[model samples]
Target: MDQAPLHVLAGALCDREGRVLLAERPAGKHLAGLWEFPGGKREPGETPLVALARELDEELGIALVEAAPLIRVPWRYHERALLLDAWCVTQWRGAPRSLEGQGLRWCLPMQADPATLAPADRAILQALRLPPHYLITPAEVLPAERDFWFERIGHAIEAGERMLQLRLPLWPRESVREFAASLLPLARAHAAQLLLNADIEGARVLGIGVHLTGAQLATLGERPLPLQQIVGASCHDAAQLAQALRLDVDFATLSPVAATASHPQAQPLGWSNFQELAEAAAMPVYALGGMVPAQLAQAQLAGAQGVAGIRGFWSAS
Candidate 1:
């Protein structure tokens, strides 16, 4: 029989500057010298929130005032299994200090390098940096419509869109590259990330990111881009999710969560099944297919980083 996982509750404590706190593991402890979110084991009979509060008090010397669910990570290190349940702690009674002898630092989520974080804590860092909605451009193959799409993309960026993918399968690669390059200034101006769908060269050339199809994901044995560039994948089942995790992908889109017009023949995973597959993934999972911006919170509660969709996410205008 498999051993039960240890329940751990962590807090992403934020300061007025919008920076989150990180703690370097003290010597003599497991995974010592690595940086991680400040938290500890969940003792029996204590709820996750209560456990987080107690851990924050013991480790950081703070009394939790307000915290919201961030993400729950299911991870394994060799034979050791643990569930890293974290919350976004916005308010606290006292200033957080390193009461447990661990070094503490506060930095912007995107500014913190994931490699410096403890293995499982990397996912927490990603959750803090990534947005709750990943918007995908619809299939539009036309030289005449290029400007139109750019206008729409610009609008979305101005509206606080952070993550987007250029998934124009029918368009030529060079044209797509040029379009992505043209938008880079706008994307950068607004701190948005523009990822190309299945275009590794374009992404690498532009120093952006790539989103791998399930087929491409199966073929690659390692991460295609450098650590600074983000990588996402399209995953439908537990096996694809495993492949994504194997590649150490930053995030994944678990699609067909609900029936839709584009893929009418494909069966839907439904929220329950989607939750199961999402839980199994070591990285963040986004519910694709039949998703809208309205369901972001529900998706997050269901173990998803958020929702990714083509139609509902973009505006008609």
Candidate 2:
């Protein structure tokens, strides 16, 4: 039997420099000594935003001014299930101090070690680190158009595309490896992360990350790479999404939110279905298939981490 999810509102109080405020659970409480985003359980009939505001005032002596939806984390902890509704509190009135006498720290997302955080808060940390747009390379890049594609990629990076996937399935292994090698420096120069699609060996050799196909994700029993390296997956349905979560993938892309020119025959999931699946996902999920940068806000409203696409992103101005 499934129990009703306990809705808890949490806020990532971000400073101007982009550090998030975390509070350590005090002694004699559940998960004591563990760090987590500061908030509390939602009172009946209270909205998540209202509950977050109340919690902040009570726990941190702060007034919530503005906040944006961050991520909704649904976690199962042995016998209990929780729905953590997180928001990025960008504008709050007072400086956050631990009014409850708990330890407080403000740190960059990457600096928030998972070992020191509550198990349920780990996914929120990952969500905070991920960018709002994911770019996927075309399936095949003609040799003659290589320079053109590179220029386009460079331009996109310059415009703040921080995460990318090179998915050249039809290219020779050696060719893909060489091309990825050449692109790594460019990606690094722009402070962007590049993931090799369905090429674990190449990714390992290149000291980069790998993006697993759905088939590869299903076959994996454990994480393929070290924790330091990013691992993402392409998931189409609930089963694949579960597998990616089980492997503890950094993120995953769920596709066909809208009909696509690339895969004309594939049916789109639509926003309603996308929301249903994404709400239950354990990790950050990017909405793919016929996606454009303009749809990012829409995707987020539908419980997605962001939007992902090939042509939509590559061709954007």
Candidate 3:
């Protein structure tokens, strides 16, 4: 018989400098010698919040003040499965000290090295660094519509949109490159990231992110870009998602959560199926297709890093 997954609570306690606390596993424990968020397993009959508070108090010798659900990662290690429920703790009392004989340190989430942390903690790091919105441009922007896209994208960046994709299939590569360049100054000033759809060289030359097509993901033997650059893939099923993990891509978009004009023929992976796949993934997953900004909360509840869309997330304001 399959064993039930262990419910483990993890707390990401962030300090005022945006640094998060990490605890290293001591000897003889499972995944020992590795770094992870400070927390522990939930006892039976305990709610998630209560369990997290108890674990933090026991493990870190501090009191939980304010926390919010960041992401829930369902991962399997050999025969053992665990649901790593993570919370972002912004406020707390008492200085955190290692009470369990574990080593502790503080570092910025984005600056942490994935290889140094436990496997599941890498997903949590991505969750901390990524926003709840993944924006993709429309399929085709005509010559006349260029100005409109530029204006809206500029405004979006100014409005705190840090990541977006430039998917202009109808335009020439040079035109797309130029357009991306035009936005670089503004994007840089605001610390926004720009990605091109399946355009590896363009992204490489421009020093931005690359959203891989399924075909490209399958053919690549290893990560095409370095760790600092974002690498996303379009995934539809378990196999594609597995391939994405093999490549160690930063994130993937699992699509068609509902029927839509873009892919009407594509069957929707209703919330149940979407959540199932997402839980099994070791990296952050985004819910795409038939998505709107309003569904952000619902999508996150289903184990998504966020919602991704062309029309759903676009706004000049």
Q: Between which residue pairs do clashes occur in model 3?
A: none
> Model 2 clash pairs?
none
Reference-based lDDT, residue 139, model 3: 87
lDDT of 3 at 120: 83
Local accuracy by lDDT, each model: 0.90, 0.89, 0.89
TM-scores of all candidate predictions against the true structure: 0.97, 0.93, 0.89
**lDDT digits (tens) for residues 1-317 of candidate 1:** 99889999989988888799999998998889899999999999999999999999998788999999888889988898999988999999988898889999989998998888999998888888888889998886576789889989999999888999999977888999999999999999999999999999889989999999989988999989987899999998999999888888899999899998889998999999998888878788899999988998888778999989998888532
Q: What's the TM for model 1?
A: 0.97
* lDDT against true structure, model 3: 0.89
lDDT, candidate 2, equals 0.89
Ranking by TM-score: 1, 2, 3
Stretches of candidate 3 exceeding 4 Å from the true structure: 27-33, 315-317
- Say which prediction, candidate 1 or candidate 2, comes out ahead on TM-score: 1
Query: Which regions of candidate 1 are displaced past 4 Å?
Result: none
Root-mean-square deviation of each candidate, in angstroms? 1.2, 1.8, 2.3
Indicate which candidate wins on lDDT. Answer: 1
Clashes of 3: 0
